[model samples]
Target: MLRYSAFSRDPAGGNPAGVVLDARGLDEREMLAVAAEVGFSETAFLVPADGGFDVRFFSPRAEVSFCGHATIASAVAHAERHGAGGLRYRTAAGDVDVVTARDEDGSWRATLTSVPPVVRDLAPQDLDALLAALRWSAQDLDPALPARTAYAGAWHPVVAVRSRQRLADLEHDVAALERLAAARGWTTVDLVWRQDATTFHARNPFPAGGVVEDPATGAAAAALGGYLRAGGHVPLPARLTVLQGEDLGRPSTLHVAVPADPAAGVAVTGAAVAMP
Candidate 1:
């Protein structure tokens, strides 16, 4: 297994992921064991398939349907060794297509096209429960953005706070949040503060995945793009930059592009660096 950090040029500045380049023979138990040993947020195991590869993501605690950072890290790692090109990833959520290219500065950037996204209203009870767990009042939320459940690859509650300080002061009941997430089939709670029309600050709580927070979550970024476009928060063909992990001292960036079509996949782009 190899270690790589996704969404940052520097290895220590992004979310770390374990990449098992060839995991043909490993079973579920062994994969879980390896993931636990690696102790990252998630690990990507690739098994060669006909068109591209079958990928499975395992967290330290359990298997998740999709993991954005691991996918980006794996694709960039693959590109570094094989060549920059398109890769079809067969994930549990769906078939995700990724393209990798080397920039002029010699950095490999990967863009993952998420599955068609969906945004739905947040149930009142669920929202109340979430607010209670975070010790946030309704006034702390952004009225323009509103609360909603978004799904691209994995489900996330996209909570837009009114202040960056509110987003930064992250204090939550981990067990309660984990229980709520597991019950709702949610992977993360995407807490965000819109800096401007095209820039945002985000922090993700991923207790269900056995992590306190995700430094850079491409899946949540894509979901946020879908939510913004669907709700007409941003204009069509919008390009937004999400700044994350600064509070944790592991800064990461996610570039999200939302097309005109609502049913189309959201594109998330970022760079990955091999970790020591």
Candidate 2:
């Protein structure tokens, strides 16, 4: 298994993912075991197909439909071992297209296009339960961005808070959220604070992954981009930046491009480095 940190130029800064580039013979049980042993939020298992490869993402506890940080790590690993190019990942959620290239500074950067996104309004009861689990009231929320459940491969509930401090001081009932997420088919509960037209700060609690919080969440970022475009929160064809993991001391930067077409997939870009 190759270990890599995605979304940060520094190895110690980004979210770490385990990449199993060749898993042609491994079954779901074995993959789950490996992911559990790795103890990262998620791990990628790849089986070489006709052109690109069929990939699977496993969290420590369960198999998630998609995992963005692991995908970024796997693409960079493939680019380094083989060469820089495009890759098609057939995941359980959907097909993801990734392009990897070496940056001018000699680091590998990858851009992954998610599946067509879908956004839904969160039910009042579910929203109330979510806020209660998060220890946040309706008054703590940002009026501009409403509560919604979004999907761009994996499903995430996006909640935008009014201030950065509210986002930073995130404390949640993990067990309650895990049960709620299992019932709602949610991968992560995204808590965010909008900084400006193009900048935001985010924190994701990934109870489904058997992790308290995900340091860098590319999947959530893409879903948020879709939500913004669908809700007309940001200007069409916009470039947005999501700052994450600062509270965890592993700062991560995720660059997102949202198109005018609400049916189109969002693009997320980040860099990955090998972990020692």
Candidate 3:
């Protein structure tokens, strides 16, 4: 059976993730089929491991290295089963450590540390192709952030928009963008807008995953946090909130913390509630 939760929410706003607590007997084909059937942006499958759990993430179209929202959902599910605390996940990408706790309101929250991240500037031609796919002009992009490719567990093209309205009016050529992303091995086109010094708005276009958009993207957020920290855009020990899925009405909020250590992974925290 599959358990569903909209992470970073009280059963309402947030990205919906599917969690399979017992995924021992399933093979890769079975997992893919299950994810397709679930039809969420991603699904987390957990199997027994040494003192912790082995996890895998699958999109409707294919398997991914790691997925942030699904990870949060899985951790919360594990917490509900084993009691709220800390848990380590051995994922396809790498080892991810997560801590789960219950708030005063009895809501379960989970914080996950990402793998080491990196950011690189996108090639001009590639950026142009991506812009064509999204119907966004170079003028629409934010001058400060520029276009770059970032990675935590998966690769995503970070495109900062000048305004939230540009982010909200997302319309893209799916097949064309899918081909571009597949050729580049990119997971998603991370569209973002800086709302303030410590707040941002984001929209993720995930054509490669066969999803039109992601309401909340944990991996991309981790990458963005790393990028910002490395570029010195935000100060050390800063906690930034990423508001996403607002256009879709899911309205997910992702909290990310960046430390001074460049080698350290970003910390992403959010609540996950079981869907009825």
Candidate 4:
């Protein structure tokens, strides 16, 4: 298994992912075991399928339909060995297309186009439970960006806080959040603070995945981009940067682009570095 940190140029930053370039013979049990041994938030196992590849993601405790950091790390790993180009990944969520290229600084960056995103209003009861688990009152939320559940491969509840301080001081009941997430089939709670028109700060609590938080969440970022476009939160054809994991001391950055077409997939771009 190859180790990589996605969405950062440095190894110590970003979210770490384990990449298994070849897992042709491994069964589900074996893959889960390996992922557990790797002990990262998630691990990618690639098996050649139909001309592209069939990718599976496993967290330490369970299998997930999609994982953004693992996808980014796996794409970069493939590009480093097979040369930069487009690659198709058949994930449990859906077919995802990723493109990798070398940057001017000689670092490799990968861009993954998410599946068509969906944004839905959170039920009042569910929202109340979520806020209770998160220990965040309704008044702390941003009025402009209402609470909604966004889905792009994975489902995330996008909760936009009014102030950066509200986002920074994150303290949640993990067990309560996990129960709610599992009950609702949510992957993460995307806590965000908008910095400006093109900048934002985000924190993702991934209780269902068996992780407390994610340093960089591409799937949630994509979902948020789609939500912004669909809800007119951001202008069409907008490129936004999300800064995450800084509070965890492993800073990471995610670049998201939202197009005018509401049905189209959002684009998420970031660089990955091999971990030593």
TM-score of each: 0.99, 0.99, 0.97, 0.99
- Which candidate number maximizes lDDT? 1
Q: Report the error of model 1 at residue 80, Å.
A: 0.7
RMSD of 2: 0.6
lDDT of each: 0.95, 0.94, 0.89, 0.94
Off by over 4 Å in 4: none
Clashing residue pairs in candidate 4 (N, C-alpha, C atoms within 3 angstroms): none
lDDT by residue (129-167, candidate 4, tens digit) is 999999989999999999999999999999999999999
Q: Model 4 residue 40 lDDT?
A: 91
Which 10 consecutive residues of model 3 have the lowest summed lDDT? Answer: 1-10
- Relative to the true structure, candidate 1 reaches a TM of 0.99
Q: If both were scored by lDDT, which would come out higher, candidate 1 or candidate 4?
A: 1
Cα error of candidate 3 at position 179, Å: 0.7
Q: On residues 1-276, what C-alpha lDDT tens digit does candidate 3 reach at each position?
A: 455554565566788888999899999999999999999899999998898889999998899999999999888888888898888899988999999999998888999999998988899999999999999899999998878898888899899999988988888998899999999999988899999999999999898789998989999999999888877789898899999888987888899999889989999998888887
Name the regions of candidate 3 deviating beyond 4 angstroms.
Answer: none
**Candidate 1: tens digits of C-alpha lDDT, residues 1-276:** 999999999998989999998999999999999999999999999998997999999999999999999999999999999999999999999999999999999999999999999999999999999999888999999999999999999999999999999998988989999999999999999999999999999999999879999999999999999999889999889999999999999999999999999889999999999998
